[model samples]
Target: MKGFESEMIQRLRTSDGWKFFGVLPQANRGLAVTWWVLLLLRGILPALFAIVIGRLVGAVQRGQDVVGPLALVGAVYLPLQILAPLHRAIGANLGSQTAAWLYDRLVLACVRPPGMGHLENPKLTNDLTMARDFDLGISGPPMSISMDFIASGLVEMIVGLASAAILVGYAWWAPLLLAGGWLATHWLLRESAVWRDRNTEEVRDAQRHADYAYRLAVEPFAAKELRLFGLADWTVDRFRSMRSRLVELRFQATKLRERPVLWSLLIVLIANIVVLGSMASAAADGSLALDRLVTYASAAVTTGMIAFGGLSWALDCSAAPVAAVLRLKEAMEPAGALVLGRQPADGLPAREIRFRNLTFTYPGTDQPVLEGFDLTIPAGTSLAIVGQNGAGKTTLAKLLCRLYDPQSGGIEIDGVDLRTIDLDAWRSRVTAVFQDFIRFELPLRDNVAPGGAPDDFIQSALADAGAAGLADLDTVLARGYEGGTDLSGGQWQRVALARALCAVRLGAGLVLLDEPTAQLDVRGEAEIFERILAATRQTTTILISHRFSTVRHADRICVLEAGRVVELGTHDALMAAGGRYHTMFVLQASRFGTEDTEEEGVNYDVLT
Candidate 1:
């Protein structure tokens, strides 16, 4: 018995119903307190009005004055009418505030961590999706509208309970008979009604599928492809099918079962018949007065509190996201968490960055992307890494930027372990143009110097990147705005390179460029490479690219294969040694060599 009681208590505390109450205060304390007070008054006024009616009836029967009872009725009825709209107005404000609070918490959980592991974790997708779209009214009604329904539902339940308590004035058994019957409907038909648990995997999966199909249909990114492939009708059909499946699953979970519904109706019918019949018999026998009968009858009728309805549905939908946001606040912090260090990392890779016996695989993979990788890059020198796709070239840059720590071994700055350095400070000293760098739709100046720098400094960096006169500094990068324009692939690459150069001017000590000039032609790439080397002469630089034209300009070049360095030397030395680098360089150089020139001559003669 004790164990069962403890389990019930635990369930009650964690239930969405309880969480709904908890969210009220988080929205606004003063408004929540006032809303509650109004709700309580609104709930009890029905019983109070009933009692006043009985008093007026008794006064008429006794041939006494009816003025006092009439006055009492007006007083009680007036506030009962006024309280609802007032309560709803307060609820709207509270609802908006609650939505904002949840969003604030969700944003913090996503970005507060220094590492990005949690954002990539598949396990969190369901909850993350739920919290993100809950208030948008896609899955259900938005919180602002749902708040009114929720308040009405709670007030209805309260009215039933308060009305039932009034039955105690007649007979104790009368209150129990009425209240018990009404309350049983909740437990008996819970699974059949608005009480389905949306947290079930099957339901959430259906929702995800439906949401994906909806996005494909509505989002602009997919619109062009959808129309070009003649898949518009197919997209609609897919959306309809997914939604139909979701509706089917919801019905299976919550559809009313006939047996339970009938049982509940019978229970309520018997309770009402017995209680009212007893009151009728007492009145006929003159054992009960007319006024007493009137009061008891009203209280007995008011016990149909759950009949106001939608308490289960509205509360469930509104509170699910609140619970999810709270859970994520606890779960996400540790999911993407990194071990932070207190040591300052300013200007200390002053010597050399060393990777010693390093081996790393991604979070969920088995094969190591970088195995036993050892390299040393002295300060103020440039090293280019060349590898085929998936040879862990970009993975090396991610490690240097501390985006993910290696599973074994470690990187050292001079002699201090890299993980022991302050994460933010270390990141501040490093800048990179990643293969998938973000293109913020802001002003060009802000895009180039996102942390804010002097106009002259940003212009100089832009000039170095061959991006001068590409656009005005204050022009937005996206074409959606009035004074904005979009850039071609090559132009965007120059802007990205300019971003890295701007960082170099702002005290960054390490620069990592991963295929920074992939869109530029061979000659243009070589020119940009020379400019980058000149600007970063005093900083440690690492470049990752497959183009020999760019790698050949580095101070030393390293050739990687199968996560291992196969050759490391100056370009001429590698070419003279006739190793892997020489073969690749020769193959690329031959593409533009004698055969291509002769082919071009033949084409020119034909045109002439």
Candidate 2:
């Protein structure tokens, strides 16, 4: 019994209904107030209705003029008739607005963490996925389902009390009998709710899989792969299998719920027979008038419907989302995590940036990607990182950009520890064009100046990135926009490059390019790199690429092997040492020579 009581208390405390109401006013104050007023009116309407019915019936039996009571009933009924539809419409609009507000908050919360650790956690990812599913306009946390439940429950209690008062005039035990049955029914419903909450986890997991499969089959990015790989039927079958499992679990839960519903119905039936029989007997004995019997009966029935239908249904529907919101809040930040510092990283690195004894590993992994890695990059000079796949080249760049902090050791900018600097301030001074850069389906100008740079800056950035011709086109970059045109892979790369350049033009001091020319042809790649180097001559640059041709142009080159720097020097010095960098460069040069020889009908292998 203590366990059950504890569970119930916890459930009530964690319920989204009240929490949602608490945040609703802050989300939209006027709408929340209006919603509350409408709820109050709705809550008391049933009792008011019972009173009007009793007055009208009593007046008729007493042979008094019934016009006043009948007119009052019409006035009450007319407004309720209008208010019901208006209430639904306003609730829907307010729910939509609140959903948008909640969604924005949820997104900001997910994005606010300084490191990528939370985003990568599988459990947190699942929670975020479930939270997103609950964020729909009608189904989301912003809705007043909980408030509605409170109001409806209040109405049920008020109506039940009024009915009990009317029954007390007949016999003092009459109210107790009715109240006992209502309490029993409410307990049964609460038990069902407890069972449903217990089983919701399994249902949510199935739903996540089903939603993922559906997206895989239909989303635009997956459409091409699905068709090419003939995975249409496979994806549909997977979706159907997961969806069927979800439905089966829900159906079983529904069956469990029906047991309590059946018990409630049986209790209601027995109570009705007993109440009506006593009233009829009293009416015949001249102890009760016919009008009073009618009023008491009406109130009794209304109280039962509000308790069983309104409160029970609200509890059943809102259990999951409320729990989801609570869990998300708890899991948003891991325990003992580093707090983001507020000390400003105002100026650019005046001397140099140093990576000292850096050792780091990805979350949920045993092996470190960078182990005791150390390097120094002079300010306002180009440094290129070259490595074979999985050698932690990109990881090094990510460390420098503060995307992930090292497990041990740290970075320093001009002698100050990176951890002590304000994260936003440090990021403001950096710009990067990654290999998998975003292709935002926006206007050309908007793409270059997402933070809104001037027209002259946008044009100059475009010219530097070799995309000046795109400026002449009046069409937007994506198809959904008015007069828009789709861009080729190479064109999109240039747009991304321009975005990075524009960031630099807007005061960013350091630019990191991670294979930005991977989409372009060999000659195009060389030309783009040349232009980038020329445009950012004064800016500090960190370039990560597989192409030795580009690495040779940088002031210094570092070859990473197994997360440790194996070689570091100027291009000519590295080439002279005949080390890993030299060997890799010779291999690439031979491959290019072989391709040239093939075009000329010569056997390069024989010549070698």
Candidate 3:
């Protein structure tokens, strides 16, 4: 019995359900204090009402005035009814405040780090999903609704204990026997009453599937594809199937067992019969006073409130997110942290940039994407990198932006190691337009110059990307807003280029363009490449593309094969050598004619 008591105490201390109590004070101290004070008053009101009713009965029996006893009943009952709504209103405000606080901490945990690896890590996915979507009422009720249920349930438990304490005035053993039987229900039916297993990976996976299917049905991003594929009914079926699986898993974890339910019923029934029978016998024999019997009988009924109930479920749903948010706050920081450097990066790369003996692999992969690679690029020149798919073309741009550090070797800007420069300072000196560039749902001016620039400068940059006539400066880029218009794929590409150009105008020295013109046609790509080259003449520019026709115009062309530089020279020089670069260029050029070219087991049709 002692060991059991110790274990129960330990579980209570470590339980996630109680963590929200600590969060209440942190969310708002004054509100938290007031909430506790009201709970105390509300919890003991039932016991006080029982005592006052006994006095009123005795006053009428003795033929005395009952006004004082009647007034006392009103005093206890009035506050009991009034405090509930007032407490609920306060709890609603606290719930909203707590949600905002959690989000603020969650955002900082994700974005405060300088590296992107943590966002891509698979291990953190479950916690991230729970913390991100908890307030949306996907897995359970929203926090505001849960808070009200939690308050009511807690008050019920407190009322039971207070009433049981009042029973001690009649017989010490009476309170112990009644309280023990009701409290035992929590232990016997613990699994069925609590949803503590909701954070398990199996449950989290089920939730993710259900949420994804729901999103596919409701979100606008997948609306076109669903209708085009005749999948409206299919999507609904999938959502229902996934939601059914989720419910099955949760029920399996929390289902009630027959043995435990039977045991609780037997114990509670035996205790109630013994206590009420003893009281009736004593009153009949005139051993117990009428007023005392009345008070004890009422107290015995109220003590049933301590049984296993809704508080367990409501507390589990509400407190799990609080614990998840706090866990993420501690875990995400070290997971995504990067080493810092204090060196100034102003006016860097005046001479050249070099990659020496570099070897790198992605975070969770074994195969190296860039192995023993070596490259050198003189400042103020345009170099085009051409490679087959998965030959590390885009990886090069990510490295240049310092999104991830190499496991071996290093990249040098001029003569300084890139890692030795301040991360923010180095980023300010570089600009990029990735293949999957962000198209913010904002005004054209904000899209072009996200960091803010003068009107004339933004206009000049827009003209350089052939985007000056696309839309007015203040027009929003998304179709969802009134008076806003969406752009065509080609037009959006030009706006992305204009954004890079704006960054360059703000004193960026290095420019990385990763498939920047992939959306444009051949003629449009050729036209845009000319503008890119002319506008970025004074910066060290790198371009990653599959188009040999466009790359041939660069100051120098590089051919990467199997994560190594196989050929590097001017377009005419590499063609003269008749090596890998020469063969690829000729094969791609051959496809311009009427027939598809197939040579050396390679089909130019698939390549194009």
Candidate 4:
């Protein structure tokens, strides 16, 4: 019992536990005070009822008027029935508001970091899962439920003392024996709670796997493949396998807990037998009056009921979740922390942007994605990067957009290192549309004008991106909304392009279009690239694609292979050299029976 108390104190002293307590007053001080007051009343109510019952029994046994004692019992029971509903309603409201407050902080803690490093960490991902599982409302933080348990425990202690005083008239040792029995029961119950807390991590991991399998089976994105590939039964089997393991572990824990509970029950039985037997013996010997006998028996039974009922269960249920909350909070703290820079990037690059010996590797992997890579783009010029898959073309764009920092060396905009500029201010000047762009489930206007551009600006961007006939501005692009509809892959691509154009309209200076025309047809691809060149004529643009014909329009083209630039020049120069780029371009143009000559610029109309 002493060890258990020490553990509880240590858990409460943890940073997350302290924050949990801190949120109560911060959410609403007046409401917190009221909640505490209600807890006090709830705690005392049980003892008050026990006392009233004892008094009424004494009055009836004495053959005196029992109306006063009966009315006192009514006074306690009637108000309690009314207050129970009120208490629950208020508690529910408080839990909801507190959950919102905590959830907001949790989201910011996960997302406010400057890079995607933490998001890629498995440990942080697990912590995030646990934090989300034990959210507010009925399954809220331990402190919320602990208040009721604390109140109940206090009430039981008070009632035990009063019962002991009444029983002392029978024998001085009687109260001591009863108190010892209750203490033993409490200790056993607390041991079970401790065991549960110790094993929660393993159980939570199993549940997460089970939940993931279920989501894969039910989520819309996987539905088509699940049916066509006949994977529904396989997914169901996986879910069942995980669930069965979780259930087996839980059953074993429950069986282990039953032994301590059996010991607690034995203690209760012995204590009750001794006290009741002594009371009957005294009554038969004519030493104890009938009224005193009734009063003592009632008080003893009430004390035992209070000791083992709601209070014990509450203690057991609240312990594990509170500990989990604390663990998750500590695990989710950002490692290096997000610090703001004093220097602001207020305008476009005046000279040039340079990547100086940049080296990088993704988290958890030793293989370098970009190794001593070097490149430069003059301001207001178009640069096209052509490469096969896994050439680190996309990685360079990610580094430039500051989604990650390089392992060594750095990128410089104008004369300042990218890291020294304010992150948000720098990001605001860059706009990108990757091959795997987002298709927002919103109105067409919202999708095209993601930066909240004016309607005229949205229409202009749409026209520039060649998406004016895709949908009306007011048309919803997803189901669940009134008059909502879905779009084809090509149409969604056009809308994404329009979103990027809208960003450009809103003052973004660095434009990146990575395989932006991959989903478009031959004619559509040519038209969109022409429009893009015209639109970004005054901005620094980097285009990545595998098609040589589309990249021929850029001011310069670079070929990347295995994380390094192997060739850099114009289309005509690369073709004349007949090197790696010339071989790929010839191979691609050969399929369409088009010669790689300077006169006809490799006709792309038939390539798609």
Top TM-score model: 3
Considering only N, C-alpha and C atoms within 3 Å, which residue pairs clash in candidate 1?
none
Scored by lDDT, model 4 comes in at 0.73
For candidate 4, the 10 contiguous residues with the lowest summed lDDT are: 599-608
Candidate 3: stretches off by over 4 Å: 1-14, 190-194, 258-260, 308-310, 582-592, 595-608
**What is every candidate's alpha-carbon RMSD to the true fold?**
4.3, 4.7, 3.4, 4.6
RMSD of 1: 4.3
TM-score against truth, every candidate: 0.90, 0.84, 0.92, 0.83
Ranking by lDDT: 3, 1, 2, 4
Worst 10 residues of 1 by lDDT: 599-608
The 0-to-1 C-alpha lDDT of every candidate, in the order given, reads 0.85, 0.74, 0.85, 0.73
* Cα lDDT tens digits for candidate 1, 1-608: 99999999998899776887787897789988998898888888998988999999999999999999999989999999999999999988888888898999999999997777677777777888989999999878888888888888778888889888989999999988888988887556665234645557678788989999999999998999999999999999999999999999877767766446788889989999999999999999999899989988998998788555436676778887888788888888887788788899889679999999999887656899999999888888899998778989998998888878888889999888999999989999999998888788999999999889999999999999999999999999999999899998889999999999999998899999998987776667778989999999999999998777677778999988888899999998999999898887766656655555322321111100
What value of lDDT does candidate 2 attain over all alpha carbons?
0.74
Would you give me the overall lDDT of model 1? 0.85
lDDT of 2 at 345: 73
lDDT of 2 by residue, 1-608 (tens): 99999999887666655565566676688887887777657656666777788889899888999999999899778776676566666666666576567667667666766666767666665567766766442232434444355445555565565566656666677667777777677666655455454235676777778788877877798999888999889998998998788778766665545355788879877887798788878889988777777777776666564345334445444445545655665566552135476778766677898999999988867899999989999999999998878889888777777888888989989988888888888889899999889877777888888779888899999999889987443457888887888899889999999999998888888899998877776667777888988888888899988777677789999999999999999999998999988887777667655546322322112111
What's the distance in Å from true for residue 446, model 3?
1.0
- Model 4: per-residue lDDT, tens digit, 521-579? 76687789899989888889999987776898899899998888999988889989989
